[model samples]
Target chain A: MHIEFEFSGGYGGLFAAKPLGYRVETDELPDEVRDKLLALIRDSGVLELKPAQATGGPGPQRDVFTYSLTIGEGAAAKSFAFDDASAPPAVRPLLSRLRELAVEQRMRP
Target chain B: MTFHKCNCHYIPPHVLGNMAKKGDPAVRQAARTSAQQAKLSREKRGVQAPKVPEMLTGIAMATAPAPVTAAREVYDCQNKWELRVKLARGEGDPEFGDDDVDTVYGYAETVRGYFAELGRNSIDNAGMNLRLNVHVGENYMNAFWDGDEMAFGDGDGQIFTSFAQSLDVMAHEMAHGVTQFTANLDYYSQSGALNEHFSDVFGTAITQYKLNQTVDDADWLIGNEIMGPTLYGEALRSMKAPGTAYDNPLLGKDPQPAHMKDYYNGPNDNRGVHINSGIMNRAFYLAATDQIGTQKAAKIWYHALQNLWPTADFDDAVEIIVESARTLVGDGVVPEGTTQTVRLAFKEVGLPS
Candidate 1:
């Protein structure tokens, strides 16, 4: 499975210059890391969630980070957009894990 | 029968009745007396009951149940994504001894008092309660205002620190509530940039007011105080000099544009709401340093904010802000030549574009 994650739009536009993004292949990860990422994706139920389920209606929310995630690619791909207020509980752990991975990967030479 | 001064005679009977039933004790007594006087006056003249206009009646009722004071409510999220998970503090309660909780409590008071000095009751100008949540999630690195309340995150301890530790950050979020009630500027394109600009305006204004700092004394950076050890001496945005706040590998360089010629015309950030705001923020900085002073310039901006509409653009803001300055000058709130000073400030930033 290929995973792509992007996060932006927080207070102070912290990511305005360069939004945090990551693309990783599950098969390329170490066994432990691969298992953890796979588990988070499974627990998130992202494949079953509709786009509408990721948003909490049109309302005023300020300075919240917006998240975008994609799994797989092309015909098998699933993508979702959500913000801090709209992200469902089940999706949060997956988002956190991806964030950590993105930071770690970025720091790697 | 002696007639008391019916100060509320113009108020419709139905509205006054509602106030009598629902108002605070003082308002209730006054409403009752006013209602009785109105009835007696009608009977004395043998006049038929006057028909109340629906709009007028609505306004009366809406403004009747006035909030006497703004209360503060602080919640601890306990590292959860959920909000208000636990009530950590309330208005007038003893100190919780938690730094985040106590710090936010005091900052809320300062923000409330700052607006109160301007005759604003609260965020809504109707004494709405202040709701805040701290410790939102594990290593959460942001803070936000979700229409009705605010939430702060303890940062990842590298690039940032506890967001609740910064007064300007709290004030910035609270000012969003004020903008929502006032101009209600659309959070896209120029209007969105204006929305962000107004929050920064109040954020720095309230900070300077609390710290007794003048234009020269203030650092004029938005998120400098929140920088953790790794990013110390850096900032998120620089109102004094846009696009110069920071430049590092972790967060990249600041992308703010100080002049309209360099305005970010991209689709990102709701059409550069945060990016384009640097233009206006620079205008404010120029005006403040040019003898108009920060608080006075803020008053002009606040007046414009109240008169502005949801879709108001940059040109509209410039015109309204200048007119507001003229009005304040006439009222002796700001000094003479303030309108010209404000116009020049905007001109420097390529405003009214």
Candidate 2:
């Protein structure tokens, strides 16, 4: 899924920079988002993020990102979380650099 | 190359522009390079990387249930809203009043009353039957709606409690379902805020109705029951007072803005939709509380919610209420102080001021 963003607010100015939001499908992620998602994979405490690409694609896209968030997949954790947990990290920071990248993309005129 | 997100993180687009157009080249370069490198990396990585299982991807991804690759491994919790029910040694014990029945029935009863009160007796309350799972993610410190069902975690038994303890909380999660079915409001930004607003509106209404209290008697707090018993946090947010919703260090102070003037901006969490909902909540609070004399006065707030609210954004909501007020109260009489109060409150927030 390659999701295209048709912003509601529309870049207000010739130089308006806004985060282009989209609905996720899981398998397809834009190039920038995929990079940071992947970056988190090798960071720490993360072993691997299973076939979530096809899952995280938010609209239409060519590829997916690599997310390395494996907080509670243990026996105890598995019994609790929903059958489909989120791939993206909620307490983001380690991905601050990636976020900045996303910010930059939004800022692009 | 964008991440499909609603982004309610409070970092507005103009701010990003400031960082880019005015900030140091290092910041701009860093941002640009990150975007560039990410694109290059995606091309390099392709689809080879395995995606994370769907079972553990919420805020508490660290402690989500493992993916069930099997065709059928449903942990029914047997309609029992109790965690201990699942731990019955060898399953020979009698069926416990896990509260699951009560939870399910409670939802049914609430909806029944809701429709009756609004003459929506035929709206089919069964459209959303809450499938709550208690004691999720073992000692997990978080609970969230996963676009489908509602799941609760035994909050590390510290920072929070079982997310199921709060009726308003349950109503909040269930409200997400209503949004998904109705407007399918995007989960971040204005749409996200609208989404949260719906939940808060519905959740608060359901709680109030369940308690048989009108708007004046109800505490306009969202997730008051979901707060950590050990900490000093009020409900997740206070419609009466936005910024002061929470003042803890762990989750940080609540960033919710009571008025549109303070509306947050960001790319994450759909531009802080959840935080921005405070504005709407406050609007409802102000509209209802501004009233002077009323012993058993009916609530236009709930009337708007059950009979009028649209799954859509503020504008759609306003239109619906204005119309519903007409239908509920009069044709040319106009709604009472409560109805006007909502509009005035919205105006006060700088939305249309």
Candidate 3:
């Protein structure tokens, strides 16, 4: 599922809509692929990553999602989660539009 | 092969053969760990972009460094969101100079060029690649390196400005590249904090060096501009004192631990690696301690960071600094005995035994 972007930007950002969580086939995946996924932790577009939270208690929870990223400096072992806030008007409109378009495209099939 | 190359030069103590009889498990563990990290760094280094002599889009042979940091191109949303077209530097056609919110991509485009230019000048043998990705998130307060590329964010502005406003932050992020290409320290616990501290130490240190300022002259704050204008504190992390950077009501106090005995531990990826990094962050300050800009100070740190800190954790880092000082000045009281002084300074914070 796709996650909705909401709140202020960056790590402490929140999600307006619920995140579309996916369970990757971890054990079967190759190291390079795992590395690539870990790299995405630093990516900004991502929001509401639950598994990404490695430390500190959760802040005002609004459907927190977990995503794994390299933690504490560079170790891939630090799993951390994030708080999901409402998306701002500057970017949320775009995501809602995209979501609508996606549904339309799927329904066309 | 006996010397495992992780950070600088890690001599793996062979328990089975050579000078020392079966070394204790501690030594063995150190050797094995260094060997493992060495293998990882080697593997990661191997993944370099394959040689491409021909330019894909006329980037061509590198030109002379720009006279100043230029904001060449800006892409409003109407333009294509393609990185290649944007990177193919050129004068504006239709969309280049508007700061319109609808097309704010121009600022990011300029940052991209800054990195591209930096990448060419910083040679591979020198061991670095300039990396940057802007427009990171909605209103991200902080930006950092994840052992690879640089990330930027539009700050909360309540406590900071955009991340780009601070050159030291850029230096700090780039130093991560230096750290990755060099020591490749395990980014957790003390080593992790060292990783953070080095980034800050080297980060702010380079900024001061580049700006031609001395230690007393340097502000010694990390991500100063990233915080909002209203905030009383100056930076995200302070090399002199970690958690003391900010104590705003919003983000709460910075929680970086200051000493080894006070080190934070949790299952969270080698214990709050980032939080605990304050200890080693303090160590580097103590190591570099009094002398800020002199070549002598940088030299001692360079020796330790380059030759000594290969796989050193907190205590190990202090040991290496002492060793590095001895190697640099050799015997009898060297000014501050940079290495010895570093050890002493760290002892002040309870790092070195």
Candidate 4:
């Protein structure tokens, strides 16, 4: 499975100059890494996470990041956006992996 | 009152979290590390030991004057997440040789002076110890008031810089502490916006007071000096024109709306607390500029703040401020027309009393 994702929200949207986004496929990774990533995603209940509305309540949670993820594409695409402060335990690994991919994508020449 | 633990942050989580996604390897690593540290901070909260009950060491004599003075402690996180790791400076320590430590110390004292000038003690209005942790994480690009203390980050040196370099930024975090002690506005919607509003207000006020600048002579920009040279933005936010702080290639246009009609109803940004704050900020600016000036306007708002509750929204703010104006005027504190000027100011921002 391939995942498409985007993340934003920070000091006045500074990092958002270009959102980190890319497609990550299992075949593109080393065998063990791919297996670990896939397993983490599968078990993390990322698919069950309901879409989180865009809102970071003021107070302690101010300026927190928000994420949008799509497990598939086109009409069959399943997308969800969530606040970083409220990321579920099962979804954290996926979030971490996506961030890693996004950074790599962003650094491309 | 329960001293609520607040995750007060200088750099919004989204900003730091984004660094984890799309920067150079070092940037991404720092971002990820800082994010993890921030998360761990929450867990640390759970494990925090309850404060030992205050020991009754001695009783004060009635003839002795009560001693109340600012007490401060500055710690160095040493580019790690843990707070209070190494003692860097203290209230009366000699120069620590670190610009971050010395700068935060000076700024904190200035903020303390601002409050003391108004007869308010420290964050708790009872001279609570001021605690700060600097160098929070490697390339960390934010600072915040984390409920009991303040945290500063050494910026990534590219997109952002050290948070300690800016007095207004430091004052902004200090102002957050003030709100926690005063109205303690809820961190949702309008209340959150108001919380941000007061911080911005005092942030600018302290800056102006420090510089000895008249209202008109002030720049009215927040975080302009500390934004570093990488970005083309002028400042983080502008009080004179809310949405006009910056419009750069990287950060897009400022999203703040000066009127309720342009209020942001989107997600993240704590229900646009920082964004929508432009409205109230502009209102305060207008009121302060013409009718009452910054000093009186600050006093009026400070009074209104004391009268507010956690859930007070924009409408409630209008009512409380107008009432505060009346009370201040009735006591011959401020001249007449203060209330009218305030009402007209809010009305201009679509919040009529």
What DockQ does each candidate score versus the true complex, computed on alpha carbons? 0.32, 0.03, 0.05, 0.12
Isolated chain B TM-score per model? 0.82, 0.63, 0.64, 0.80
Indicate which candidate wins on lDDT: 1
Candidate 1, B121-180: lDDT as tens digits: 788765678899999988888999887789999998886899999999999999998887
**TM-score of the A-chain for all models:** 0.89, 0.25, 0.27, 0.73
lDDT of 2 by residue, B77-109 (tens): 432222224432111224445553334334534
Off by over 4 Å in 2: A1-109, B1-95, B99-108, B111-129, B214-216, B292-312, B331-338
Residue ranges of candidate 1 with Cα displaced over 4 Å: A55-58, B1-69
CA displacement after TM-score superposition, residue B283 of candidate 4 (Å): 0.2
Kindly provide the TM-score obtained by chain B of candidate 3 when compared with the true chain B: 0.64
Interface root-mean-square deviation (Å) of every model? 11.3, 14.0, 13.1, 5.9
Number of the predicted model whose TM-score against the real structure is largest: 1
Predicted candidate 2 versus true structure: per-residue lDDT over A1-109, tens digit per residue: 2222222110000011232333332256677666665554346222333444323322211101122222333342211111123333432233233323433454445
Q: Clashing residue pairs, candidate 1?
A: none
Tell me the lDDT of model 2 at B67. Answer: 31
DockQ result, candidate 3: 0.05
Task: Summarize candidate 3's per-residue lDDT along B215-249 as a digit string, tens digits.
Answer: 66766666665556666455566767766876644
Q: What's each prediction's clash count?
A: 0, 68, 37, 14
Worst 10 residues of 3 chain A by lDDT: A8-17
lDDT of 2 at B171: 62
TM-scores, in order shown? 0.85, 0.55, 0.55, 0.71
